[model samples]
Target chain A: MPVLYASLLTLFLILIPGIGIGLFNMKALFGIVVLYGAFLIFISGVIYRVIIWAKSPVPFSIPTVCGQAKSLPWIRQNKIESPHTSWGVIKRMLLEVLFFRSLLRNEKGRLKTGGRLLFYRNLLLWFGGVLFHWSLFIIIIRHLRLFLEPVPSFVEFIYGLDGLFELFTPPLLITDLLILLGIIYLFFRRLFDPQTRYISISTDYFPLMLIFAIVITGLLIRHVQKVDIMGIKAFLIGLFSFNPSLPKESNTIFYIHLFLVATLLSYLPFSKLIHMAGVFFSPTRNLKNSSRMERHINPWDYPVLVHTYEEWEDEFRAAMKDVGLPVEKEN
Target chain B: MVYDKGKVITGLVVFLIILLSPLWYNALSGKVEPSLKLSMPKEEKSCIEERMFMRSNHMDLLIKWRDDAVRKGIRTYKGLDGKVYRISLTGTCLSCHIDKAGFCDRCHGYSGVKTPKCWDCHNIPKEEGSKV
Candidate 1:
């Protein structure tokens, strides 16, 4: 099902740009408005989906356990994974979200000499995944510099930091290259690993392909395609001011890039990519393990009337007598 | 064994069909131009041929400073018209790169910067070819 959805989604993403470009170029105001309206729906839908998930009820405490549960005072406990209190949960969530501590700690076990099991940290996978996510995040934040009028001080700061190692002649972006490499490794792993390959569907391939498309298109526009930067800035400025005028002297790759990006935006909520927001509302990550200390009554449970044991015995007196069984009360 | 073989053959054919269709389409479509037109009026485009053109950059910086002045309206600049233009400088890059996704990508794609979904907020102009 995910494969089918992803395939259709990929096709939609690929097609929308062409259609939107066609509509936009033709000065079809209705088409542009409708397409943009659809875009707005997807963006808002993502937010709504996230909020609904945030407000939804969890019937169980199913946090993935890596450390000890918060229990007896005499025994040491791992507060991060199986947190008992809000603070502990927050700490655990921070580590999980910020550093991917759980993913970092993941290990693959293999049989060793003398039939002993050997657990080895999957550092390469962990590092690759971590690098991909962190760099992706930094890239996202850094790219925000392009949207704002007066680039935020923090954005400039990050840009400065990223460009700190000007090792390459033109100065290479470590995070950018790191993110691209990391995603490539992940894609390769999924394609090559038997386990990942078995479970993988077209959706898995779609994001990778789309993201690679976005990245390559962007790189080409910047370093190779050599677009009219000034004109682009003019158009960006106009858009920020809510007066979007087509920039003069723009490149075609830019259109391709924009089209791919719009597709990603329109598809985010429906895809597993929602995990970015899902982390915050995840019951396992956010919910406290208070079941041991306090009884959690499911809000959905309702009161029901049933016969008491005494009443049941009275009602079934004739049957009980025939069976020669004891009753709750002598009826 | 026959059934398994049939399924395998079916999957291969599907994969080949999926891969070939795009190749066929591209072959038939010729070179797909950007959705937007590239040519501008000669006066506007004269800068394209100039290697050491500073007017665009100068204008960019001037407009940027002008924007800052306007936002930080307390400051004032003497414009070519001789009237004082507001010189507000509360800097925020989002001020200009509003539709980073839409507008910047037009050029950045050529420049090779990874484009993001920055357009959800800022609207991109319809490409000339695809313009409305």
Candidate 2:
């Protein structure tokens, strides 16, 4: 089914550019048009999505509380989980963005043989998520060396730290291995977990397969394909500066890597991959749990015309008096 | 069940427009084609490496040369054609590619690539007058 279709679609995406640039020599198309197009789409689409999310009104203070809220002076409050102020919310967001604190607390439940419930910390998901994100960040930072002309000191420092082991000729980067392992763990988790498998759709599997293909192509370029690094830097620098160029004898693997990256960038806005940007605008994560202290009036709420009890009484007074009923005002 | 179809459709339309903005811009502006230029040396018949290899890998070769000359004190580079070249920017490369502006900046300027480090230690030839 869906998984098969997703896998095939992902394979086709990888192959189209892989073959186009590698075999048909459509390097110029992939290098210039695809790269620039993807970048523009990525930037504009993200901004559009973020703006749309921002425009949507949050009518209530719905911050998810995982720990004790601010109550009595003597009672301790969990500022990170159940924030009461803007500063507390900032801290909570920092923890959520950096460490995925909420995900870290995820638990799995099972029914025991004696009909008792059992709960266990699901550390594997958290570990894989953290590893994937951090490694991806490090890899992106390391790639700055190619885009930048002078090769910034921070990028060099990260690159040095990543290749400190010096295991092989080109020196194996730890993040490379970590990202691959992380993606593998995540993919397998989705497949093995019955609950996850039941809920998973083609979209879920497509990104995983796409990312796997991207990472594999990248690895192949670094180790197996033997691409000209200087050429890549030149091409990238040129690209960023608006004067684009492709090396005459560019490696096919490089084109594959670039195409996959382009595909990911373009697909980001439409797909669930936009959770990266959506997380910040999420009402549950961004809002402070301060409904107890401060009243939240919905900005969209309108003043309504209503018949008050006093008005009702006045209107009915004449009719009541006519019928000889007791009225409050005996004018 | 009570869904704002109009709002949802508007959002979808906006999303689609944003996603297709690049393609639209490209079609309208006619800036899709990319032009690349590399400077050709006047006197030198062959570089230390092949023309195609040099075009793509000149920066790497230069970096390796810089490290070897500055750190290891090895100034000679054995070419693929069994020729030993004395690896110095001013003494070797600039000798035949006399005008930095005409030879180097032509391609670098077209590519919008800035290499400030090359001139940090070595003085730019006064004849060219620092176009970069």
Candidate 3:
């Protein structure tokens, strides 16, 4: 019930901006103010989150170790899993960030009818996650052509590579299909799995639905509804260079796509989407597992007033003497 | 399990400031909104395409013109309005839009878009009454 309401709310949020820009011809407002504002929020939000994470003092080396720690020279150590040095930490972080090594190792627990609990590798989730992230990255890079003039050769190279399949007039990009497939798989996984559905919140489903909408609208513009590419480039170039201009005959689908993108940008920092930045500041990933070799003290630890035994003795001296108790000094 | 109130507040404050920087900066500086510097063509009331279509899709038309003229040895285009035009940048486009600086450079310069490679193989026309 909460999920349905949240999904509808998210849909409404995207639809309003999209319809406003598309139908009302509010391209100038959506293109310039909304887009730039979203970018500002994304940048500032990421920086703020990182700063907060950095300021928090980790009083313990709490790296989540999945393998053997570095010890005796003869014994094998998993440097990538149980990092003991900064370099090892960097290597581990690269693998985790780039390949999602941890997620790749994820296992789904299932109880058999005979009362036996078994764990099986869940490769579908890992594949979907990797596919979605990588495709999104490539798509973003490909979009650089719109923002930049005389589009860079590398961008052209990537664009060519993406459309190498060449199934149509404007050749189909493999990443586009992969991203769509990945998002669908993830969305279904959340909806179908009882355990996942039980733990899932509105925030979790909203982004998926939002991204799905974005991609669908984008595909509509590219294939079905053919927008003015020159106009889009001109508008985007003007927007970035601070001299924004709305092109004549703006396509509704293009505006819809742009509005959704803007919404995603603005909502990223406040939502769990900030895991993109949070991953770098995570203690479990960033910290080295060297607590056995070195001690970590809390920097914020302060001295407190303590009632010493000597002070207690002094305060009770008279009473002790009256009672004729044995004393160290005749105070 | 102690929460750092100071860190949290500072983070929120920084986030707000950064997010609102563009608005505040623009307001304080009193910067005027920028406009594209599109110049009117001399001796031509209309282009090969509709005015609105030309504004947004001139590049596509130009690219098609270039490819047709160079690769297919076709130099004429039958426009949407049923008017045929010779596909030559220097011969057709620059002939009307004589002042490249005032006409082409206007929006391109304002938007920081790079000039097309049309000039690589052709001579740039001099301004009227100016010796090359």
User: lDDT of all predictions, in order shown?
Assistant: 0.60, 0.77, 0.76
Q: Report the lDDT tens digits of candidate 3 across residue range A1-331.
A: 6469768976797778667865687866876788889888888777777767777888777889899998999999988899899899989999888989999888999999999999999888989999999999999878766665555567777877898776643557899899999989988888899998888888888888888888888888776666656566666656655677765536777777877898999899889999987787788888888888888677677998999878888999999999988777677
Q: Pick the TM-score winner.
A: 2
User: Which residue pairs collide in model 3, if any?
Assistant: none
Q: Which stretches of candidate 1 lie over 4 Å from their true place?
A: A1-39, A51-56, A111-118, A167-170, A313-331, B1-132
The DockQ ranking, best first, is: 3, 2, 1
* Cα lDDT of model 1 by residue, A221-322, tens digit: 655555555455445444434455555643456666766776676777788887766776676677777678877666556789988877877889989989
Off by over 4 Å in 2: A324-331, B1-132
lDDT of 1 by residue, B24-55 (tens): 43345443222333333233323221422322
- Measured with C-alpha atoms, the lDDT of residue A152 in candidate 3 is 59
Tell me the tens digit of each residue's lDDT in model 2 across A120-167.
998889899999999998998777666554555677778878987866
**What is the C-alpha local distance difference test score of candidate 1?**
0.60
Q: What number of clashing residue pairs does each candidate have, in the order they appear?
A: 46, 0, 0
- The C-alpha stretches of model 3 lying farther than 4 A from their native spots are A305-331, B1-132
